[model samples]
Target: MTYPPPGSGYPGPQGPYPPAPPPAPPGPGYGSPHGGGKTNGLAIAAFVTGLLGCFGVVGIILGAISLGQIGRTGDRGRGFAVAGIILSCLWIAAGITIGVIAANSDSSGGSGAAPSATRTKPKEVDAQKMKVGDCINDNTTASAPSTAEPVEVESVKIVPCTSPHDGEVMAVFRLSGLTMPPESQLRQRASDGCKIRTRSRISRDPAANSLANSYYYPTDESWRSGDRSVTCVAVAANEGTKLTRPLAR
Candidate 1:
């Protein structure tokens, strides 16, 4: 090979490499790698809320916003955003299915009308408000024979005459008293008044033989509270028996 002078600039075998092309200006959008960037804040929030299932719609909105941001800014968490959206959709679908099933179950349960139509139970009424011909039942002892002890009751349930019942009101009478009568005298007065009032009615009913007269009288407290009315009821004569037909009919 020929040699040039010591101070002269000379080309090498490759003739001095190209200038390096200004380092190629770095490729477009060439920052950190896709998953190496900062994590997307909305993506984290969406994932946490979606796992709870209570904020499904909110999670979906946040996930969509995160996905858009991730595409534009090349941030991390793309998989988290997509998973959040999918989980949110699944939770919403499950909630809708449960609601539909509950609605259908309720609709099916109340479809029948026969049970409510022929119901024997009726509204309750105050015992003091019992009127003649009102068929009634109470929570006291089942039987109310003529000789049975007095029952302390606040209310009674009025039922149909055809339904089985404990008692049926035959008459109502009032006792005149300026003060509470003695217990014995009170019972006597109530018993006398009820018997006198129900005597004629009992004679007319052919089924009266199966019935017995019972009376409701006011207590000392009730008498002080301005209650002076007494009610006469015809009940089954036998203990533990329920009257099936109206005594007056």
Candidate 2:
């Protein structure tokens, strides 16, 4: 074997063989930088897949994570993340809009409120607003209505009493007969049922053997409704008055 000397164009087998030409360009350092682009593409694909599916919300979350990773590593998932976020927001907005629309549609079933232990009462019912000769009846102890009777003259009012007991005072009258003042100005002294003879005189009569007084309530509606009268006693101005009358049948 002939050994070549240094500077003779022949390796002397003493140093590192000229570094081996950098190992053939390192076979494309980093396995083809194209891999980074692929990572970003995969991220975008995943985001789209998630958005189109029912898992849009999940997609958004995953996309966000991928985007974060891309920012940190220069990876390929950024597109996916952005798409997911947009779709997720749209879904959320749709749900909210639907809720608002349903609420305002005026459906009886749509009414809602947290259940409260407190009982709510019905509002006041004004029977007086009935037609001139119409009688109104309530569902509770209040008497059924009778037809109203508009008398020939408007001067007379039939102020009637019911059971001769004042509904308001919670007390019964000792005697019967009109409790009104001599002058007919204040036609009805006691208002048991609030019925009035718009054009008739009011008279009270004690029950034939019962401690009850009957006040006559005359109205044109009562007469028309085939009801001649209502018996009610005067009501006191001050009594823990009923907040409202029960609903009428």
RMSD of each: 13.7, 15.9
Candidate 1 similarity to native, TM-score: 0.51
Error of 2 at 93 (Å): 1.9
lDDT of each: 0.83, 0.40
Model 1 lDDT, residue 127, Cα: 87
Give each model a TM-score: 0.51, 0.34
Cα lDDT tens digits, model 1, 1-249, are 977878776787678676554556755665777435799999988888788889859989999999999999989988888888888999999999999988886666555533444356676988899999988888686337757677688889999888888888988988896888888888888888888988888878897787788888898888889999999888878877888778765
Model 1 lDDT vs. the true structure?
Answer: 0.83
Clashing pairs in 1: none
What is residue 147's positional error in candidate 1, in angstroms? 1.6
How many residue pairs clash (N, CA or C atoms closer than 3 angstroms) in each of the candidate models, in the order given? Answer: 0, 43
Model 2 / residue 163 / CA error / Å: 34
**Which whole-number lDDT from 0 to 100 does residue 48 have in model 1?**
83
Q: Compose the digit string of candidate 2's lDDT tens values, residues 83-141.
A: 76777778767878888888775443444653232323222333332222222223333
Model 1 regions more than 4 Å off: 1-120
